[model samples]
Structures are given as structure tokens and as C-alpha cells.
Target: MNDLSGLLGRVGERKDILLVVLLLAVVFMMVLPLPPLLLDILIAVNITISVVLLMMSVYIGSPLQFSVFPAVLLITTLFRLALSVSTTRMILLQADAGQIVNTFGSFVVGGNLVVGIIIFLIITIVQFLVITKGAERVAEVSARFSLDAMPGKQMSIDGDM
Candidate 1:
């Protein structure tokens, strides 16, 4: 084990580099092709991570215990995006994504094209509306914060008093 340091060089101390490389790999997936086997493995890992995250959130008593939640969430979101892009590219260019995606499509569509299109549209619209609502809330909070931070507004209130 003494030689382990020279080999891997203290991975625990370089977690930031690991995270950045992982994120870069996710971005590279958008441009690179992935084999079906690797895609299946990645899909499995994504599902496992998502389930673990969900379970932790549900069981945890306080936020402090999972202070890295936001970072994990961001990384997972990017990973999912990359997987989606990669899967779509494979499906369009090679006519195959992976067994996991194929099984999921068959299960969701039930071998019916019309029903699948309808379901896809419904899901897309719901996602779009949810994101729009979240963005609206963020904008409202940002505007309110800006207004509250105005020095002239505070000064004017004090002068009136």
C-alpha cells in the first residue's frame, strides 16, 4: 500500500480534479459516440445515483448533513443532459441507444406509435411549464432583492421618517 501514493496520488485530496474531469466527460459525451454496452452501464449508474440521492433526501433529518446536495444535483443534472444527448445521437445516427433505453421505450410506448407520441408531447409540455414557472419565481426573487438593496430607497425612507 505504500506504493499506492505514487500510483494514484491521493485521490481523496484531489476530489475537485475528479469532479471537473467527470463533468468534462459529460460534456464530451455530447460530441463523442458511446457504445451500447457502455451506455447501458452509464444508464445503470445514473439510475443508482438518482435513487440513492432520493433516499438520502427523504431519510435525512437536516440539510447540514447533506451540505453538498446542490453540487451533486447540478452534476447529476448535467450527467442526465449528456446522457440524453448521447442517447438521441445514437438513436438518430445508428438506430440504437442501449438495451435500457430500448426496454424503457417499449414499456412506455407498448409498441404503439400514436400513444408514444402523445405521451412524449405531454411529458415535454409538462417539463417546459415547470421550468418556466421556476424561472419566473427566480426572476421575481431577483427583482425583489435588487429593489431591497437600493441605497437611495433606504435613504429616502429614512429621510421621510
Candidate 2:
């Protein structure tokens, strides 16, 4: 029990270091040639991360509760962009991207390029207009309330002094 607790404590303390290492690995993936199996695994991991983020946003009680969300969002965005670039590179050079892309292109898109593009655009717009806009409004309201409360906070400090 003591050993387990110590291991957990050490992991908790080094979360930032782990995050930095993960970020570096994501950056390196853009420059390396990943095997198809590894690429497929990474793609599945990306989808899982997106689902987790969506669930977190849905269940969060307040914006402040997830103060680190913006950084997480940025990192995920960069990670996805890196994956996109790497996938494109693989396709252009090797003429074979991976099973994930091939499956999506064949099964989801059904070889219909225009339909796939339209679906992609619609998802992007919905994400921007619904999720991003709602979050922005919540952040604005939170900031306004914080500013409005500042005077009372100042008064309390003055009284304490």
C-alpha cells in the first residue's frame, strides 16, 4: 500500500513533465515515418481524446473549474494538425496513408469526395458555432462577474488591513 501510494504521488507530481514529453513526441511524429499499425493506433487515440474532451466539456459545472482547458485545447489542436500533416506526407510519398484514413475514405465517404468534404465542413462549422461560441460567451460572462466583484473584494481587503 505504501509503495503504491508513493508511486501514485510521484506520478501526480510529474504530470507536467509527462505532458511536455508527450507534446515533444507529438512534434516528433510529424517528422518521422510511422508504421501503418502505429498510425492506426494513434488515430484511434486521437478519436478517444476528442471524445474525452467532449465529455469533459459537457459535464464541467463552470468554466473556472477547467481553467487549463485552453492549453489542452491548443495542444490537441496542434496534435491533430501534426497528424494531418504527417498523414498527408505519407500519402504523397508512399501512396499509402494508413488503415484509419483508408477506412474512412472507403467506408465513411464511400469514395464520394464531395460528400466527404461537405460532411467535414458541416462538422467544423457546428463545432465552431456551437461549442466554441458557447464557451466564449461563458468565459466573457465569468470575466465580467469577476470584474464586478472586484470592488467588494477590495473593500474586504481594506477592512482587514
Candidate 2 lDDT over 1-161, as tens digits, reads 99999998998899988898888999899988887778888889999999999999999999999999999999999889888888888889889889889988898778888999998899899988998889999999999999999999999999999
- TM-score for all predictions? 0.87, 0.65
Off by over 4 Å in 2: 1-11, 113-161
Ten residues in a row with the worst lDDT in model 2?
33-42
lDDT of 1 by residue, 1-161 (tens): 77996557777778888988998999898889999899899999999999999999999999999999999999999999999899998999999989999999999999999999999999999999999999999999999999888988889999999
Q: In candidate 1, how many Å is residue 13 off?
A: 0.7
Clashes of 1: 0
Which RMSD does model 2 reach against the true structure? 5.4
Error at 155, model 2, angstroms: 19
